[model samples]
Target chain A: MLVIVVFVLVGIVTALLWASLDAFGGNVEQTAGVYSTIIFFVLLVGTLVTPAVSGGAINGDRDAGTLATTQVTLATTGQIVLAKFLAAWTVALTFLAASLPAMLFTVLAGGVRLDTLAASLGVLVLELGVVAAVGVGLSGVIARPLFSVVTTYLVVAALSIGTLIAFTLGGLAVQTERTQTYIGIDFSVGGEFDPVTGLPEEIVCLEPETYSYPVPRFDLVWGILAANPYIVLADAAPTTFTSEGYPEDLFGQIALGVRSAQLPIVFDEVIDECGAALAGDPNSAYEFETPQEIFDRTVPSWFVGLAIHLVLAIAALAAAVARTRTPAGRLPTGSRVA
Target chain B: MTSTAAIAVEGVARSFGDVHAVRQADFEAASGQVTALIGPNGSGKTTLLLMLATLLQPDAGTIRIAGHDPVADPRAVRRVMGWMPDVLGSWAALTVRGALETTGRLYELGPADARTRANELIELVGLETLADQPARVLSRGQKQRLSLARALVHRPSVLLLDEPASGLDPAARVDLRVLVRRLAAEGCAVVVSSHVLAELDEMADTAVYLDHGATASAERIERSRATARDWRVRALDPAALAAALEAESIVTSGTDHLGALVTVSGEAEAAAVLERLVRAGIAVSAFGPAVGDLEHTYLDLARGEVAEQPVIDSTEAPR
Candidate 1:
């Protein structure tokens, strides 16, 4: 709850501060949109802290000498493991449930549709559950509470958000580029670049038919860019992100939700000679194509978030349960060590 | 023969890497009788108890609770057996009561039954006041009592106690002794292992003395009790009972050689011999029945000539 309040309140207050200072010519609506992005920050911090704090609960109990009493009795290992897993998973669920208001705030600002919100939350729950399970399994292997927590979190992060994330994005990159070529995105792009370099040294304007070295940043370019999937998904949520991807691409799409790495470029702006085109947008002259499929393809953010959270919670619970299922004599507790 | 040994352990053996914890050990705790498993520190008394409890499967030989095989059908054997380990190990947060209650619940007692058993055994072990305290707060004595309560909570007919007197003060030791006596009286087969030999002298009907992981000796419940040997004494001088016994003669020499200060090692029918002495005109001061002090006799028997130790070749089949 404290984490939720801190992140959400700061988002609102920072946006209000920007509006008050007239940072973007006193655009209140734009400031509201920026402030409402609090949902992302809440999940980001939650992902890191959840796995750190309660991840070592089973190992902690073993260290505390409680496991031995259970082991020597009629209590089987399964019962022991289930009990520990539930206790840790409950903490993760509590944090997610308590922070509901902040999630709603993003919806009110129109940045997240109801479906996107639900899907995002669903993914968050699953991802975080997997993290928790990984932590628990590591706890059994390590036998020390502190080491379990550190190693589980590191391993979970590496698998879920580290290397796998980069691979997922790179795969999504090929997927989106292929989809755009067939979906009339080629008409808007005007001439292809080297498939290897992808560093388009110069880009041609869609409306003016003029070639330029630096791409003019604009709302259309920022929202519809092929490189940043989150931006393309947000504007063309229900369609663009889904149209060209395989059925299994749902996994890559979910990973994209937790990744904030792509958003910087989406929000970065280049002062174009033509009254500062929107971030990464090439020009203002081209007619922006607003497809309804965009909103349709945007998987619900809440569901995505919920999935991540669920995965993490389940994984932690499973690992904890497995640890508990081990024979008392075999458990990591110092007692019955032989 | 005995009606049916409640616990029959025949040549049970267990080993760790290089250590022989239990070997060629044959022991039995008969129904409605208390058997004392007395041994030294590494004598394997507790290991034999564990086999009776079915907590350990023997590396060789067989053990049973009543007629149930302890190794092959442990669950059935378990229902009839209660085991109290030596160290209760409650130097943690959970209290004696909590540990006992949790243990009871694990055996699948109904909630109400578990609670009732927990409370009953708590009071039984004299830990009613400390029920809610964490285990870590308990003293060593309190922990052992709680562990005993936990073991007895299931009302098992066969109870295997590994050093039940451990961590107990003198008064508590006496109390525990009385409790074990009562349990045996109630027809529960009990095998109590203890380093304190004297406590088992009065409490145990049978004594199975273990030495170096094997049965050094097995004495019947009655024989182990050692009712004193009867003796007839006739002093040559009136009021000379002490001096006459101390005088260096065949009787005194025999007693001294056997480490017995007073020469009293024959059976009750020595009255005939006394009559012969009286007929010979020897003045008799007093003639009375004498019973051996088992504790003292045990100490003497333990000293040397262990050549008298019983050796049972080919232990009978378990159960």
Candidate 2:
């Protein structure tokens, strides 16, 4: 019942927020952006609530003196733990199911791509399952229900917030000194300058000036962000680009940020002011790739992150199964079997 | 112990860190008998039962529950063993019938079978009216009945009940006694542990006494039984009974309102005293041992141990 109330509340809030965006003249692409935000919020809330649902599943039974009764039955330890995992996963998915109405509202707003919908929803479901598995596993491994639940929440925080901090710190720690050369037109040599083109009449070449600065190498630590649940959700989604090479939705924007991190800092970058003045425009001299181009060049890390989460979930559950097996030898201190 | 016995345990010991819960337990209980596990507080009756129920592994021992080793093949033993824990815990959110049905499913019963079994058990435990009510609303005794019904869900051949009568009222306790006796009569081996000796006296046909984590040796038990013990003889006239007991050269210990106490060596002498009292023109209302058989033997063993080791706190000794 608590799960239902929480799910409904999140759904209603997402709906109202989406409706406000539409009323404020949200275009097709913006509508898609609003939908991605709603989906991301729903996934975030689902992940947070799933741990609470499953965290007390095993240890709570032990505290209530009900676990040993189940253990004594014909049901093996594997069956008991697996059944709990599946039940928790299903309960977590119900939160997603509750937001179906708002999701439909977003789709009706138009410009919702098929690949984006499928990939984001798939990743969201898998992430929720992973959280559920970890909660149930920790409940078995830890003797106290309260301690295990708190530990589960801590693990969630470490994945969601800790990964980001680590990634930032990691990138800043590994800096490379980049040397950039700037070639300028000798404005002092000419008396008259073109106001429209911002160039000297003679277009005389000045001595190349080299300046060095440190650049944070995010490429070295982007894998840390890969383990972040939010990053995995965003990066896994199929990003859509507009005609101007701008991201169409929140997923595309976030994915672009991760992709942009992959480009290496140019050590000997040369900016030719003389050549720019000789050409039609000075701004035309500097070349920068659009988000779409960077996204296209980079490799996707969502699968790697998803694979790591799945392995952790599996390992936790496997450890729980081993710890909870009956006819048990040594028991944890201050714990009873029944 | 014989393999055919329903429960055969030898040299079974389990410890939790420095505390030896069950140091050395040896006993065999046959099918169709309610064997009482008699012990004082913290004497490891529950620990031994846990081993038999396959919930804990013994540090050193061999345990066979219904001819299957609980450690080597816990599933085989669990299929035939039902354990009613001393602690009364029920799924608070589930209805009485729902809890029973869930327990049946855990025992591998089909949905329909589980429902049917649940209905039958609710009726058997006499909770038909409260079947739909959530378990949290149940009183202590009702919860006990539910626990018993749950343990019986699989129709196990071996039953282990720890402190089964602790919280039951008189009427419920009677019902529990009758139900356990009925189960035993159906050829299920039942082991009951309780501090209530009188209750076991009425229900159990055989008893195994545990003291300080050790089962009483057979020789020690024999010695305790052969030793002189008190018998209460109540008559229509207490004075007449006292005089009659005195006339027969019987040693009178004391007297209470209900009866006069006399020391007797064995059951034969007790019977002889009863006959002599009857011949003396005293109408005997009741003539029996002052305490139940299990309680008497248990107390005697406890006393003998204290006498042998005067320095150690008898209760704290880990046998």
Candidate 3:
């Protein structure tokens, strides 16, 4: 099943990559955005979906009633629990690995740097560990496999959907642009997010609509959820937050004719296009933003959230395995049968 | 200790909370033969079997399989003792081969060896056609057979079958008896617990009669003659045999296996005893000493027994 999931994931990403391949005009910035788009879907789909599938594995075996017989054997509770989680995680990773070559293209196109890829992989490993933990823990305590599966999935769903919805409603992000904003955008410090250039996204938008497009995990779009450090750092500087006309002094000539007339810049564009301002008066930018600055970038925000999820998942797995080892709950079998 | 003892229980006892299930139960099974443990329900046969399987520990007494203590050397005992529980917990979702393979692996069989053993067991249980079928779909008899196959897959030195034939039909039960006999022939000590008298009578070489959670009585039946009286009487006139019994010197007893009216000679000569019968104004009959039988005595003893003993906990039962 793990192998199957990998193939399916690969197929989907390959199809998406194949379809979009002819469309990328060799622009580094545009390619980075595409990279971000691909990873966004992978994490959401893999981390969220895999837990639900693996959550009920051991519980299902118990429900089928082989536990007592198996218990009498030399196999320990740890073996069974670990096997179930591994099977589930392996299947999910298959899908993640399937898209490896396709994801590599984003690097080739300069959508995201190799360090960003490495860091994102770290986040992925952590996310999977949490997913496997949810399945293992739920299966150990819950008798009904369906209940375990449903319950774990609901947990994953609540984390993914709930975080996005809550953060959006709380005004932490632009509400109108959902998963789409993450596409072809780089919110990371060095990412070119411009859709036309296919590179990591630069902080060029003061408002939601003018924000840098997704460049996979390299951009601040990932920070909207994961809390990556670079995204946190980028958001700390206020030069890109209020000075709308100051981004990229070189692109100012191009910015003049962006909207029609002298359009008022949004907060996103002010922060995004502040390179022009830095060239003129670097000190004129916003300073000492602190924690509030984190929300303005992608990596810091997304990683922080990702860390919380991973911690919760790992805790759940440890608890489940520990309980399975001792199974001291039934005080009635001895009393009745003896 | 009996030389043919397959499994022996010595001073075994177990208690759960305030209730005691077995107390001071002594048991033994002979090698290369079937020993039946017979008792009323709740007599702790299952508990004792489980203790022997190393699934539980008896609170007192020790269980030894071929001289090795189950509690002290469970790993070694586990490799040699096969247990078929009263209830078969079906690996319902797993195919027959898949489930057996898992157990084989746990028994430490190499992959190729496990497959080979699994195939042999599948055929032994006559499940070759259903080797890939899910356990959940099998009939009750088929499930029992599958469980039996699983227990025997390791070719253990001792086989503990707790009511292995309970749900089986008559024909299936016959097949079971044959299989068990074959196992015993291969030098395996087989301890089979059952409530069925006829089945045990046909299969067991020895009977451990469990009464009130202890070994109330035990008997080994080989080619030994019954201990009950056996008599041969020759009547000069078979029609007048009852009349001759009224004579003073000849004391009459009950009828013999040949349906003849039997009489005992009281130290008198054979002719004198016959003459005494003839003098009673009746026809004379010939008589001899009577031998004994065991089957009827065994049944009578079993009928007088009851259940009062507790089962030994898996942690403390004796070997």
Best by DockQ: 2
Model 2 interface DockQ: 0.62
Off by over 4 Å in 3: A1-34, A37-40, A47-52, A71-77, A94-110, A142-338, B1-26, B39-44, B58-61, B66-73, B87-102, B132-138, B207-319
Decide which is better by TM-score, 2 or 3.
2
Runs with alpha carbons beyond 4 Å of true place in candidate 1: A1-69, A91-154, A157-338, B1-3, B47-54, B70-72, B90-100, B132-135, B217-319
Q: Which candidate leads in lDDT?
A: 2
Native contact fraction, candidates in order: 0.13, 0.81, 0.21
lDDT of 1 by residue, B156-221 (tens): 899888888977999889889889988988999988888677778778887777755777554432
| Model 3 lDDT, full chain set | 0.60
Candidate 2 C-alpha lDDT tens digits along B72-148: 99999999999999888899999999999999999999999999999999999999999999999999999999999
Sort by lDDT, top down from the best: 2, 3, 1
Residue A121 lDDT, candidate 1, scale 0-100:
57
Q: Give candidate 2 misplaced runs (Cα > 4 Å).
A: A1-4, A19-26, B235-250, B272-285, B310-319
lDDT of 3 by residue, A41-94 (tens): 566667666766787776665555455456555666577677777888887776
Global lDDT of model 2 = 0.88
User: What would the TM-score be for candidate 1 when compared with the true structure?
Assistant: 0.59
lDDT of all predictions: 0.56, 0.88, 0.60
Query: Which CAPRI category fits model 3?
Result: incorrect
lDDT of 3 at B117: 93
